[model samples]
Target: MRNYLTLFLLLFTLQLSAQNHVFVETESFEDKGGWVIDQQSFVVMGSSYLMAHGMGRAVKDASTTIKFTKKGKYHIWVRTKDWAPFPKGPGKFQVSIDGNPLKQVFGESGSDEWKWYDAGEVDIKTETIKLSMKDLTGFNGRCDAILFTDVPKFTPPNKLEELSAFRKKLLNLPDSPVAAGHFDMVIVGGGVAGTCAAVSASRMGLRVALIQDRPVLGGNNSSEIRVHLMGDVDKNYYPKLGRIVREMDNGDPGNGNPDAKEYGDARKTSIVKAEKNISLFLNTYVYKVEKQNDIITAVVGRDIITNKETRFEGSFFADCTGDGTIGYLAGAEFRMGRESKAETGESLAADKADNFTLGTSNLWASLPRDTVTTFPETPWALQFSDEYHIDNTKADWEWETGFGNFNTITDAEKIRDHNLRAIYGNWSYLKNHKSQKYAKQELAWVAYIGGKRESRRIIGDHILNQMDIQEGKQYPDGSVTATWTIDLHFPDAKNSKYFEGQEFFAGTKHIKVAPYTIPYRCLYSKNIQNLFVAGRNISTTHVAFGSTRVMRTCGMMGEVVGFAAYLTTKYKTTPRGVYQDHLPELMSILKGETIEAQP
Candidate 1:
């Protein structure tokens, strides 16, 4: 009887194993080839996917090795979206198993939403198989994940929640995240603001963890995006406030420079790595936060490629993500877009509150070559005639998008794609239509990462406004000085006449103002006790943000926040407590005075 029972159990286990499925995340591929991991839409798409950003030329194949338990027929499903669905999508690619290319072409389903497409079935004779994706158009083809299952008539989940659960179940991920480490401060961004904060806090004898989603730091000023640091760092209310920011500046490379080294990616990385008290975690995205009442207890981040989740606990946290991602997750009070003139009492404020805000730019540049260069016709890109096309070799901040038509955080991928179409179409016309003028010009660099201007402004005790700058309002908690003009951007009227709703060009008018200092109260969240916000997301009206949003000014905000953080740790109080109770100590630290805590 015992022998018979054992035989039945063995058969049941085999059947279960045979029906199992294999899931492969494209971002986790060992060899990604020319494909790049894009996490801009991760919030809406559920995960980071691989994108072939070849700029019109087909990229090298992205391949990985997969193993199967038994040799049999399996069905395949690929998660992808046709980024440009109208007039046929340009991003088309094919999947291959063991060296045999599949018949189904991906990224052409005419659907804007991300969904799984069935790729039929294939016979597997070997346990080890080579899986790969071949880009056909090189117009930003994307693949999220691939699934192979032995169970017949099986379909993968399409909804975000269901898909997330399915992935976890299939990947066998832990229910709880692994503890990263306890820290005095956990900074959620690696931009200039966050980098300065980490450096300042670390130098002040606090253990810091700087988490950045991308491989490199400097945010928009990095080589990936290539925007130069602007605003005045040398002229400050507190002379010592922008010292750290000045140390990281790599001279003005100008926006959309072709050379990557001019952006100083290595210099920024080394600066953070040199800090002994700072533990830098690159390529980590923070998606969730743990909160107790109004205070954030911890933040949960996942490895963009490996998908491993980590819990970072800290006594205090800083929201320097520019998008205010940490503050949003922690339920901190925040505002997006513009405010009404009646509400804010500012002259620059709109008559009524709406979704209008500064746009995002994906700058591109071309260089003169020794020989004539040719570019392919982009039929799938935004069509432009000689009468209505931009006639420039390099695109500066003028090549912008997502002013009122899209959300900077949710529709980031769409905005980026629109910018690409505009860029390619314009360049094609310049190269092919009017070859004489731009015959020797070759496309040098195009930013796949969009340089954003504004997003969610996490509300603090004080919301800086336009009058405060024009009037030069003084506060006892004056910190970082703002010297840049209130430069606000709007869609170019000429481009609007041609592109209408999808205008890609931008125009800005600079409103000059005397140098003014931002209050320290504007650095910490009003609701969330332990939260500190810097960068463009700090408490500010849309007009005030125009000046404060610049990288140099934002970096100084980080320096002030860092000093305030030290006061919090020394006094064992919240950010507000430090502002109300220990303002003198924070002011002293900002003035270059040393105030060590008693042991």
Candidate 2:
């Protein structure tokens, strides 16, 4: 008979069916950093995941031998808030079970704290066996916990269950039911771009619906895996985008999770809901697109809380799925991954254009301050020259990428990890080992925002090209704008023959023209006439996307798409017509609005 604890865990998991199976540590284990006993699902060490150091590993990468029994149909789920720290620049983690190394099962050895996933299935040849984990330096690793349960026996009711009354109402909709539901606009994705898109478009006299996959509004910036919002808007050198950009950045606490009133852009769940025009749909993903000819008639969004599908038809739709989901589902033409130089004439393109694009991140962040020294100094402590790595503690973050290949998953997960790794790796370089070590400032804050760069590029009327960007091209029908500089990623930063590595040091290269106008032609579907697209997936050549893919730009583009949709509904005219003959009217509406939001 299974223990009562197991029974309780099963029942409790069924109750909170949507969440990851959580197994708290009843007994404190210091050998594993006590696991923090956090109340919040992802609350690392009961304070902030970025406290003292950015990531939490297997305490100090201690050797752990676990024996597994109870074989039939048992799948092990390892939910870790884990990161593989680098020895010098980037390191790998090694695990072995049943004589097969975990790298074989997990595909790669590196990850950015991807949690609540299958560590791999355990096939029991023998009743008992040992699973071992050791970092590249044989010292540092981040492990939250491993949960083993009978996959088949752990099933909840066959029928989907509903959580809230709102979800119950949505669940009853038929497959193609046309909802009388009227939303001013439905904005998908809640990243920096989506957040700004919802706020901006709503300010233009419309009820807004914001749908996100995660519970939090700030996809990357939420407490899930800390990443501070950084870009030209950090007031680095660009100052014009200051107000709207700074609106998100409430300031930094220089400490643990500060109050919303304190510092840091508190884009947490509650804060996002306060906007009246913005109806926050947390944990809802658009799984289906209802189409009428070329236009997206409605979006069938899945409310994860109740497992119900609700169709939301709006005046206009914005495809900010980051993966170009809405347009793709609606059969709007789209492109995936990097195009060869021959394909787009992009300078950084490879011989053959591959769809190995970047995707979402699973991240981790920490505050390794100068105050306490309890943070472990592992045998894998990175020793580096002034260039590759810096040598101090405060700013020295040992996060970088080594595992996962770009061939599979189109490098989506890898891109996410690399971007996150860069955050920590860049911090370490600034903190300790460098010519500018003396100039290093205290690592003020690590971001909850995971910076993901590339994804699906939705096909549109015109693909923005690098040469056009170089020449500062403008269109008469231009509705959106791109102020950021053009910064392209290299084909291979690591010089791999088959796989292109990441660009080590890259930035917004100043364009010949700043704040260049983006044409309305580029906003709508080339193939699907009524469909609209936005975000990093807009019609842009590979090189041009490098500049326009930033979240702020995506937000601006989303707003424009919404506006075009609004015009189409109000004047009963095609979006192209508004640009061709009625330009004065469109400009009038866009110019008159000041963003005053209410909940």
Q: Whose TM-score is greatest here?
A: 1
Any idea what lDDT model 1 has? 0.90
Encode model 2's per-residue lDDT on 1-599: one tens digit a residue: 34754575556546445432222221122233222221112112211111112342332322334444344545565433334334232333444554566642221344444344565555555555545444442222334334445544343221112112212222233445445386767778876667766665665556778788665655444554444443344321222233343455544432224223343335444445666777877666577777777766788765443344577877666777666778778898877667788887766565787654433333332344444322223322322234454233332112322222342223343443454455454444444434243342343333333345565677776788877666667666655556667654433333233223543222224444455666767776677655566677788876777677765566556656655556665666665666666677666545544323223
> Can you give the lDDT of residue 80 in candidate 1?
93
What's the lDDT for residue 122 in model 2?
55
Residue 571 in model 2: shift from native, Å?
2.6
For candidate 1, lDDT tens digit of each residue in 180-260? 889999999999999999999988889999999999999999999999999997777677888899888999989999999
Candidate 1 clashes: the total is 0
RMSD of each: 4.9, 11.1
> Which regions in candidate 2 have their CA more than 4 angstroms from the true location?
1-54, 57-184, 219-275, 302-310, 340-342, 345-352, 355-388, 392-449, 491-512, 573-577, 580-582, 593-599
Global CA lDDT computed for model 2: 0.50
